[model samples]
Target chain A: MTSTIVTAAILAIGDELLSGRTKDKNIGHLADVLLLSGIDLKEVRIVADEQDAIVEALNALRKRYTYVFTSGGIGPTHDDITADAVSAAFGLTCEHDAEAMRLLAEMYKRREMEFTEARQRMARMPKGARHIANPVSTAPGFIVDNVYVMAGVPQVFQAMVDNILPELQKGSHLLTRSLPCPYGEGDIGTLLGAIQKAHPETSIGSYPKYDGQRFSTELVVRARDEAKLDAAANAISDMIRGLDAARAGSNPGPEA
Target chain B: MTSTIVTAAILAIGDELLSGRTKDKNIGHLADVLLLSGIDLKEVRIVADEQDAIVEALNALRKRYTYVFTSGGIGPTHDDITADAVSAAFGLTCEHDAEAMRLLAEMYKRREMEFTEARQRMARMPKGARHIANPVSTAPGFIVDNVYVMAGVPQVFQAMVDNILPELQKGSHLLTRSLPCPYGEGDIGTLLGAIQKAHPETSIGSYPKYDGQRFSTELVVRARDEAKLDAAANAISDMIRGLDAARAGSNPGPEA
Candidate 1:
């Protein structure tokens, strides 16, 4: 870990998610975006639309990580209480912001639609929070106490993330190198463990993929240092080749 | 909420998920299964492949909820440390079980494959844990304390869940009634709030969806009691009809 390592967590809030009615797309999208920004997405928590659950998760994640990004419950509805929960988390009252209300009202007015109180609810945010622009929808997300509250809709949530990511601090990009090993994980586990111990800084991940007939492992080495990453990848490749050679030497022909 | 309500939290352990390489399919599948079993899937957390991260999350979730279900990190690989993490969380040793070894040996012998030590890693589990059968794959998941550990592969995970769900305790099923209101949530929020107040037992969730031109709210009322659920659903329907009538009466015509 480096001194400038930026860590983040995502709090996906929705009852639909808890009920298994909605398969989450935001978590993966946000994870990719955060990784590109050199932010380590250390943890992710999904909770229901309940205020206490959201508030509790928000406070815990916000304290533990460098930044906490929340999706869902920022819509114009009664159950969309993300802003309120965020406000409650920080001991602040949620009130409609002048600027957010102005944007929403202007948009609704231009469209000849009712700027109903529920529509105005999207403008509500915790005190002392900065508004995050939502390019897809006019309603803005808000950032309070290192927590960036965004909409739950995939498109809207993605737009808000795109708008906010550039402003966040970045660290050294974590680079990765992968090698496809034609052997089962058991065949390479001990050697892989040794290699991982040798290269402590580079995080080694052995992912097993079993085909219909056999299993193969994909060894991925990730690190901030390019040199160390390359070294680890090369070492893993050599280990695989050595294993193959030994197997071939012992059994010259096809297995009986 | 009833005294017999069995709550659960899923700890999805995998670096691939955190890195955005694999979109999770296990959480939703497990959630649906738990719901059918009358288990409330209250929370879900995703963490990296690190043992400390997995152990910390496992400990927190296992203690907080009635059951903590985990998926991923239990495999024959260097980074598959879920078993070790579970053992550490409960202060138990992760050693290969005689029965698990016997099963694996028999399966491998039948398939005419090598029974390497790495392959034996799947047999390792926390001391005093009960094995959960995996119909798809022979590798068994284990239940330590209230934590049910399963594999990451979607098919295998689903199979393990099916094998385990019937044996766990069940609670009263939470049934839901959804009312699709064409009116925006703001138009019905106040009334919905009042209705929710009248029926405190039901959980009213207001989910808003935008169709480019207008926003509609999906008001979902969930409760264990069928009578209370029906009562709340009826109240919501009446409110929607009243709003539509009011809107038509005020506008008089459908022109701009």
Candidate 2:
């Protein structure tokens, strides 16, 4: 269990995110990636760009999870303070890194944009931090200790994460299967209860959706073992199909 | 400042949340509530329902933030182990609560449904925990020390929080105002930079939006001080309006 265990936490920093103006879709994306990789997503946090708040969150989450990924607050704007806050969390002073500056300088030269003082702020890094390569934007993300500080924008963050994921340690992947049922949870609740009782290793979830005219349910089966997951899903699917077939046979079709 | 400061971190639990299948909107909603009441949202975390994962996250977040609000995993399903994990975090025992049982019994009676063992499982609460009244659902959320455990469903979780918020301590409220400009961020970036320099107490954010054919910008002013927020917004608004007026005068009307 110890060898298979891996945990991760996400810290999203920005005022735009807190205001509900910018709906954070990245949390879900990262969570899925970590889950598939068998890294348990232990926690996620959203904080304002205030240094104190970000620092406090970083310190706490880093100590708990194996890895902490932070998004937002790493941009060129004055409000971008994730790097500074991360540095503060580790009790390190922030400085403009020569390597980071070189990367930004090259990016600016290629784009033909002035590398002004404001833009230069993007090159600042916490002491002893290594840059996470950002292909889309010139200003690379940095990794300090176990924390992976990446961009807020989805595309850039995804690219940065994709670049870094292969290098990190991974655990056995989580497995899952879903069976769609035309009936509501009420109709299949008893069968689900029996299925759950029999398969303690598998987790079964019932999700109900209403499409205005009709109601449908999606029963999902999940487990760490691929064979167990498939077996459990097949059993549940067979049970649901059996019930449907029995009802159809007894009723002998509405047209008849 | 210490006396006036109130902090909160949201812990979202369950595999469904980490997956893109379900977008966790509770973080944004809770952030707005916390901000409006002057309680700073320090962080938000999404974790799977594994015991150690949940325990580590709860323990870490509860210690760092003044208040920790957790959503999801407190249901009848097998994956719903937030209460158990939280209890483990505090080194407490989980037990069936008389108050919660009574509430569940009443709810079941009102709905004319049998209060089965599975439904009764929802009544289990960590020792010495106080119940957070839920008007929408009978499964009352619990508060143990600094941690508030709420439902995963958006409406139910919000209802539980609404009942709990009034009872909790609040900090100084954050105030914000938005001023829109017809030009893009690049056009008014210089003026916005000056506004930040002049009002160091306030944070100015510039957001650019492209509506297919044209580009527009919204400059937002935010601060803990209401007067400072309003003043900064007014100054930014004046500068933007002046730019628009200058453009109007220089270009003249289409007819002219």
Candidate 3:
């Protein structure tokens, strides 16, 4: 057994996000990236910039999952308290990082922007943390134990993740194959149940779609084992083809 | 002064969500609803279907936030373990409800779908739970204590929330005002600092937007008090207009 059990979780922190002022696109994008990298995304939580809430979520998620990624609330605003809450969760003190401050100072100097106390607020880091570089923004993200903290902005968060993903351990990639079936979910439920029983290791999903005129369904088969996945796909494809043939022989009804 | 403080948190469950197979959208929608209803969405967490992860998140978030909403893993599949996990969180047993079974049986009969053992799985509810009717889907959502368990599908989740939102208590709504300035964030940094100091109760945010022809910034002012929010907005707007007039006379250049 390859022990294909790599789990991860995401904690999104921000009042704006929870208030729906900013729609979070990072969760889905990160999920796809982590899945393709052979890591099972297990859970995601969105919390406001409250200290107690952040601390509770952090402690719970970090202990259960192999990796925990948090986004937002790392800005210079008064409500940007994710760093402090993260520190509290781990029982560590947040301090200004010399390297992060240097980076911020250098960037501000280059742009002729004032490095005010508010701007310097971005340089604070939880004690005993490693920095996750942000290419798009001067403010650097940090990693404490299994938790990876990044900015909430989609562009900045993605850039930081790109810099960090290559270094993490990945399990066997999950393989999926899907075939469109011109049948209703009711008609294919029995077949799907049988298929699921036949391939215990593989997971089968049925998605129904109605595009104006036709009622179509997509049967998806997924597995971590490449060979088993392919075999399951072939079996499903054959079953669908047989169903289509049988439907043709009968008096085909009007398009549903 | 009426002191109204409303808080909510979201708990997203399932291994598929963390593995990035499904992009969770219910959190954002719920966040919007809660905010509009004057409830501060305090926190959200995505955890696996594992008993420990779900139980820990529930206990922590429930104790900290006023209300907690959960989505996903409430289905007929073996991986659908939210009901069991929620029951464990409350130190209760998972039991089949006669009312829930009645609802499920009626739904199945209406759809002409078989009431199989798998379908019966939908009737399992956490001990001492109230039902949340799902207008879009047959499977009804449930509430235990302060935690509301909803479906994972976006459309269905929205419908379920719509049915439940009006019943929940709402606090006084927060007000927001914005003033657009034709200056960069760097230009208005000092002025924003002074504005923050002047109105300690408000949250002022500067967002930079780059159109093809020009660069401009928008200063958003937010507060729970309408009078304070209006006062801050007017002051910020006046300051930005002054800067605009001064710059036009001094530079006499095209907007960029």
Candidate 4:
């Protein structure tokens, strides 16, 4: 509904992720980066390293969102098939990229090691794709069309995100305001619903947290327009205050 | 293909997750639990609180995997519409269930709180769905067909997984053996590929780790059958030792 919102979907590829051997650190990191950049991370899909699964998820996500960011399976291993899978998804041929190969060759030369066939795998990408720099690791990630391919390692992925983010076109920033309501959701649910209905453009989310001693709800109102956000947040605050006053009148204590 | 492998997909529902306001704590926890239970978590999807998005993802995952687990948006708030989305997905009416209402009413009575319309929303479920107990909170998750809906709270989600795991019939345990290769993936990539080709049934995953000083690859072979696992693991060990011997003949150093 917000036309100015730039949407993205993340495709996390690796067998270790699905097998529970590796806990993914890239999704949240990318999510935070995208949020700050005014891009809406709309969906995330985690699939195994199988080429078909990766290709399927990649194509689907790329078609749905403004950008598709893929993490993992871009390393120097037999299971590092993200490049090939992504190429396949775009109907492009995978080949060793010149700049990527140059970077890897230089790094390997400095280490006095052979850039073997397996090591060279890190240089492969879909033809015509531009390379994204990786300061942490010598191997580079690539960007093709709307897809940005990055490494799976937390440090390398974060670096690539930083390097690529500046080149992206910015969109309208989504404004958000969080109000901590001491009352339970049950106590203020009706009033909150009325506020949401009144301000249909703003998305009001109620998240309840129980801290052993008491239950509290954090009401987050998000919208593209600042006016809508302010209206919804003010309405929510008034509802919370009304509930608090009623509770105090009955209980007549600070605990209320 | 491992026909005996029971596959599952997780659908994480919430606008908070998509907006990056909430770092998802449920996926990794569920993945670890499902892996230990002999169920392969094939895919995971994080979608917004919108009913259409939830229903679309839920239907897609339910039909694709042996089981589907959904977490979040099942609370007492206007935005908590997961039950309605799920019911719409299955063409089942969403209404208050007697057992769920009874459980929630008792809990509210114990706390001397009013079970308002919003609080009662937690008791709604699709027709013919059975309730899954929530010891952390009285509002129960539900299981309809192959879908298991659960809370988004980490503690509550984990408790539901523990409670429901024993009830489902488990498949053959996926056995895995990891061999720590001192050599990098590039050093053993070709040999590892040959070994993988020789053993078609076992899935060999190469995970490279850099521990500051050196880069090493951990070769993890997973299979349902024990014989296939042992065969693949032996082949991998032999390949690593062959690389080690070759390295020693060339360098003849303690590092080699």
**Two-way lDDT contest, 2 vs 4, winner:** 4
Q: What is the TM-score of each candidate against the true structure?
A: 0.92, 0.77, 0.82, 0.94
lDDT of 2 by residue, A127-231 (tens): 989989987666789998899999877877888989889977797666778889886554566667788888888888876454544446677887888777888
Largest TM-score belongs to which candidate? Answer: 4
| Model 4 chain A: worst 10 consecutive residues (lDDT sum) | A247-256
The complex in candidate 2 yields a DockQ of 0.26
Number of the top-ranking candidate, with lDDT as the measure: 4
After superposition, the stretches of candidate 4 with alpha carbons farther than 4 Å from their true spots are: A1-3, A251-256, B1-3, B211-214, B250-256
The residue pairs found clashing in candidate 2 are A43-B45, A43-B46, A44-B44, A44-B45, A44-B46, A45-B43, A45-B44, A45-B45, A46-B43, A46-B44
Tell me the lDDT of model 4 at A42: 85
lDDT of each residue in B32-81, candidate 3, tens digit only: 78878988777777776677888888888899878988887776655567
TM-score (chain B) of candidate 4? 0.93
What DockQ was computed for model 3?
0.36
Per-residue accuracy of model 4 over B63-149 as CA lDDT, tens digit each: 999999999988888999999999999999999999999999999899999999989999999988998999888789999999999
Best by DockQ: 4
Q: How are the candidates ranked when ordered by DockQ, highest leading? A: 4, 1, 3, 2
By summed lDDT, which 10 consecutive residues of candidate 4 chain B come out lowest? B208-217
What's chain A's TM-score in each predicted model?
Answer: 0.95, 0.85, 0.90, 0.93
What are the clashing pairs of model 1?
Answer: none
Instruction: Return the lDDT, model 4, position A243.
Output: 81
Query: What are the per-residue Cα lDDT tens digits for candidate 2 across B77-126?
Result: 55567888988999999999998999889877987867777677788889
